[model samples]
Target: MRSAIWVGAILATLAIASMFLLDPSLWFAPERNTLIVQTFVAAVVAAQLTLVTAMPLAMIISSLRNRTKTPLPTYIVTVCECGAVFKSKPMFCSRCGRRLQEPQTKQAV
Candidate 1:
C-alpha cells in the first residue's frame, strides 16, 4: 500500500516534469499558458498531498503491525524454597516466612 502511494506520487511528479520537457512551447503559448500552469500546479499539489497523507498512514500501519506481533504471558507460577507453590508472586513465602526470590529463567543451550 505504501509502495503504491509512493509510485503514484512519483508518477504525478514525472507527469509535471514531462509537460515541460516534452513541450517547451506550452509555457510560451499565450492561450494555453494558463491551462498548462494550472495542470502543473495541480500535479505538484497532488504529489505533495499524497506524501503528506502517506507518512502518517504508514506510521500508523507500522505501529499496529508491531503491536500485534508481541506475545504476552497469560500466567506465571512461582515456587518457594520451602516447597510452597504460588500462582501469583509474593514478597514472602507462606510456609517458611522467608523472603521469596524471583525465579530464574533457564536459557536453552
Candidate 2:
C-alpha cells in the first residue's frame, strides 16, 4: 500500500511537470485551470484503472494455481512435490513451469 501510494505520487508529479512544460504560458494565464485540472484527472483515473486491472489478475492467478495443485504454489509453500511419494527441494527451480531436476516432472518439461 505504501509503495502504491509512492508510485501514484511519483506518476502524478511527473504528469504535472510534463503538463506544465507542454504549456508554459498556462502558468500565467487565467484559463490555465483547465490544463492543471485535466492533468490531475487523467493521472488519477489512469492509476486507479491500473490498480483495478492488476488486483483481479493476481487473485485469479492464485485461485487458478490453488485449484490446479500443480506444486507451483507448493514450491512457494516450501514443499517441493515433483513426485507423488516424496517432496524434495527443487534443484534449478524457475516457477514458470520448468522443472530442472534429475528425473523430469510430467507437469512441464
Candidate 3:
C-alpha cells in the first residue's frame, strides 16, 4: 500500500512538471542553483518508482506459490515443503517417495 502511494505521488509530480512545462530558470533563480536540486529530485523519484513496481511483483510471486506447504504431522518427513502434492487417503510423500504413518492404522491399533 505504501509503495503504491509512493508511485502515485511520483507520477503526480511528473504530471505537474509536464502540465506547467516548468521553466528551468525558475529553479535557477539568480545563480541557476536549481540544477543540483532538480537532478537529486529526479533520482529520488526514479528510485521510488522502481521500488513501487518491484514490491507488488514480489508480493504476487509469494502469493502464487501454491505448492508450498509445511509438514507438521510427522517428525520424519522434511519440515519445509516447496513443491509437493499431499493426499490423505494414501498417506505418502510423492516427491520424496516415503510413506507417512497411516492414520487408520493408528486408530485401529
Candidate 4:
C-alpha cells in the first residue's frame, strides 16, 4: 500500500512538472487535433494519479481512527514473611521457604 502511494506521487509530480516545463509552442506547432488529444490525455493521467495517491492516506487515517487500545493484565502482589514482595502470587515464599498466606477477611459484626 505504501509503495503504491510513492509510485503514484512520483508519477503525478513528473506529469505536473512536464506540463509546466514543456513549451506550449511545441504542442501548437504540431497538428491541432493531436495537440488537443495529447493535452486531454495528460490531464486525465495527472488527475487519476492524484486520486490514487490520496487513497492510501485516507485508508491509513481511517484505520487509525478505528483502532482500539487493549488494557494489560493486572498481577496480584504476594508479600512474604521475610518482607519480600512478589509481583505475582507464588505458592511458596522465595526467601523463607514458607507457604504464602492469603489475605484475611474480617467477619461482619
Candidate 5:
C-alpha cells in the first residue's frame, strides 16, 4: 500500500514536470484558456491524491511509534549484618563475608 502511494506521487510529479517542460507558453498564452483550465484541474487532482495518501501514511507511522516499548527502571538496595548499606545487591556482604539476603525489587510508579 505504501509503495503504491509512493509510485502515484512520483508519477504525479513527473506528469506535472512534463506538462511545464512541454509547453512553456501555456502559462502566458491568452488563447489557450482551456489548456490552462485543464492544467489547474490536473494540479488539483494531484494535490487531492497527495492529501489522501498522506493521511494513512501518517497514521501508520504514528501507530508504529506507539507500538514501541520503553525499558523500565529498576531500584535495588541491600543492608548487611554489620549495618552497612549498599546501593546494589551482592552475593555476600563485603565486610562480613556472609550470604546476602534476596534483593527486593521495586517498580516505578
Candidate 6:
C-alpha cells in the first residue's frame, strides 16, 4: 500500500518534469503549454483519486480477510497448591513460585 503511493508520486513527478524537459518550445507557445499543463494536472488528479479510493478498498479487503480467519483455542486453567489459579498452564505459580500440576480441562467446542 505504501509502495503504491510512492510509485504514484514518482510517476506524477516524472510526468511533470518530462513535460518541461521534452519540449523547450512550450515556453513560446502559450496555448500548447496550457494544454500540456492541463493534461498533466488531470493525470495527477486521477492518480490522487485512485489512491484515495484504494485506501478504503484495501482496508475493507484486509478486514474481510481477518474476519475469515479461524480463532485460536481458549487457554486451560491451572491451579497451584498455594491457592493460585493461572490460565494457559504456567510452569510455576505466580504467588508462591511453586511448580504447577497438570491442568484439568474440558473439551473445546
Which one is best on TM-score?
2
Give lDDT for model 3: 0.55
Write one digit per residue (lDDT tens) for candidate 6, span 2-108: 66556666776787678768987775775976776676677666777788898899999999999998776665566677777767677777899876666454335
lDDT by residue for model 5 over 1-109, one digit each (tens)? Answer: 5655556566656765687789897667775667655655665566667778788999999999988966655755577767777777788878888887664434443
Q: Give the distance in Å from residue 90's predicted Cα in candidate 1 to where it truly belongs.
A: 39
lDDT of 3 by residue, 15-90 (tens): 5466346675555466444544565466567767778789889899888784485534532323213345333444
> Candidate 1: lDDT of 73?
57
Listed in order, each prediction's TM-score against the native is 0.40, 0.47, 0.34, 0.33, 0.41, 0.47
Q: Model-by-model lDDT, in order?
A: 0.71, 0.63, 0.55, 0.63, 0.69, 0.71
Q: For candidate 4, give the lDDT.
A: 0.63
Q: What is the lDDT of residue 5 in candidate 4?
A: 53
- Tell how far residue 80 is off in model 1, in angstroms: 36
Model 2 per-residue lDDT at 69 = 75
Q: After superposing candidate 4 on the true structure, give the runs of residues whose Cα lies further than 4 Å from its correct spot.
A: 1-30, 68-109
- Per-residue accuracy of model 4 over 49-106 as CA lDDT, tens digit each: 7677789999998898778644444545567767877777677877888886672222
The runs of at least 3 residues in candidate 3 whose Cα sits more than 4 Å from the true structure, single-residue gaps closed, are: 1-32, 66-109
Residues 10-108, candidate 1: write the lDDT tens digits: 665677678778988877777665665576577666667777888999999999899888465576677787778777778888888998767532222
Which pairs clash (backbone N, Cα, C closer than 3 Å) in model 6? none
Is candidate 4 or 6 superior in TM-score?
Answer: 6
Candidate 5, overall lDDT? Answer: 0.69
Output the better candidate (1/5) by lDDT. Answer: 1
Off by over 4 Å in 1: 1-30, 70-109
Q: Model 4: number of clashes?
A: 0
